[model samples]
Target: MVAALDVGGLGMDAQVSITARPEPISLDPRRTAVVVIDMQNDFGSRGGMFDGAGLDVAPIAALVQPISRVLETARRAGLFVVYTRQEHNSDLSDAGNEDSPHRIKHRRMNIGATVEAPSGIRSQILVRNTWNTAIVAELEPRQGDVVVSKHRYSAFFETSFDTILRAKRINTLIFTGATTSICVESTVRDATLPLHCT
Candidate 1:
């Protein structure tokens, strides 16, 4: 005869042991989406914003190849792929006083100031349509992929990210990108909110 399995919680005086089993989840590609966050030249390339500011790009650059592989695999599996880019207007009109401190600091350090990008556009770092704001070549978005531009760390803040996800009927999101503690984490936290998809 099989022994009875007590699956409920036991009190301190109880002396029973329980074994937990791992369950494998089958993912439906149609309902899943991959969110690639801020994998741009400004944060991952040499002579870019972060590098020009004396920040090491090696760590962030290391994620490129792996993320590219993931993008390829996800596309092959027919999963929706979305890329989020952080950028501001050339005239700094979109950036209010909230980012003034950072701008002032970078200006003081002679970094992140207006510079001539590879595209021949004279703009500050992460300016839209400039080379520094473009997604890295290794993981560029394909024809069917979606691209969202955001000015804040959290992609959901004043962005069409949620609307696009809902339009595609996406239920699960896999986030992959650079600077795990900042933009990536912020996006993840915001994505966890209850989405009221019509």
Candidate 2:
């Protein structure tokens, strides 16, 4: 499909014509991967991150079943399945100071406050090895699945995501997960860029 996107800016009118494939493309099982992003308990489950933050998790929760179905179908079709979980070190040492402002915001909103897990482990939201950092049970990775733990919104950032994709000879990526505007979209945008995927 061809789209004419209006690129209007600074008192000027401009349009960019972009062509996109109209029909569904066939995938080669060996060269394609299904990337499931940030469907961790923190983002989708009750008493999890979103809940603790006081955000309505209904919409995010709605994605689990459908994504589970996709994962099943992808597995049956012999496609590589990669699950990305957003997590930080227990001490958050990798989070750096630039995100302190956001951390402050989370604190102000009572989102990232420390809490005790059902297992009686105390940790902030999305900290590594915590309940909130684990993938939802229904969509957990199987024996052959690939699990990538990421600290940033983009799965490819400072991670072995690209290396894995290349090593697996994956030329195409199918992405599905929560927070369309944040983690999911961030990964998609990065994947669409030419990033030496070979």
Candidate 3:
């Protein structure tokens, strides 16, 4: 028989009982890294062009407090920290024309909500960097934090995230941030392996 898993921030936090388990979980600081995703103003709904997109960002905002606690733990353990942003250029030409590497579907509309910004994320096929694409302020990065720019949802796609982790001999990954069903899920699918974190 399998046990029901309690998930989400503070949802199943107190459910973990390692002492009752056969084998305890262990983490090796030298082999672990933290990957933070899309905690930007756009998603955080603080001061982005798409702030009025009609989605409640409070849940994510609340999650950040606990996530920051975990982040501090990672820092204390001397683990690596990586951040991802989905910002793209307005010209669409910055990534490419039709076959541009950036490949943002409605490039203009998403960035600061050009003309179609009022339309909401209806045709938001591809998203990229804009003035509001930086990570959220709650869990802001400290000095030496690795920042990566990703055109796609996965931070690993055609980016230096993998290279940097490998260079540091990082095998375990601690992923945290907003939009769990979208960006977070995408990263997990795109990642080459399983991630280990609290």
lDDT of 3 by residue, 1-198 (tens): 001212223332233222236775444555667788877766675445445555577777777777787777667656678888876655444355655534444344344244223225332212354435656767778998888887666787778877787788776666787678877888877675544212
- Per-residue alpha-carbon lDDT of candidate 1 for residues 28-112, written as tens digits (9 for 90 to 100): 5567788899999889988679887788999999999888877776776566889999888776566556458545544543433
Candidate 2 residue pairs in clash (backbone atoms < 3 Å): none
The lDDT of each candidate is: 0.75, 0.76, 0.61
**Winner on TM-score (1 vs 3):** 1
The C-alpha RMSD in Å for every predicted model, in order, reads: 10.8, 10.5, 8.6
Candidate 2 residue-wise lDDT at 35: 90
The sequence of per-residue lDDT tens digits that candidate 2 reaches over residues 33-85 is 88999998888887787877778889988988888888876776566899999
Task: Flag regions of model 1 displaced more than 4 Å.
Answer: 1-23, 98-112, 118-123, 196-198
TM-score of 2: 0.82
Q: List the residue pairs that clash in candidate 1.
A: none
Question: How good is model 3 by TM-score?
Answer: 0.69
User: Of 1 and 3, which scores higher on lDDT?
Assistant: 1
The predicted structure with the larger TM-score, 2 or 3, is 2
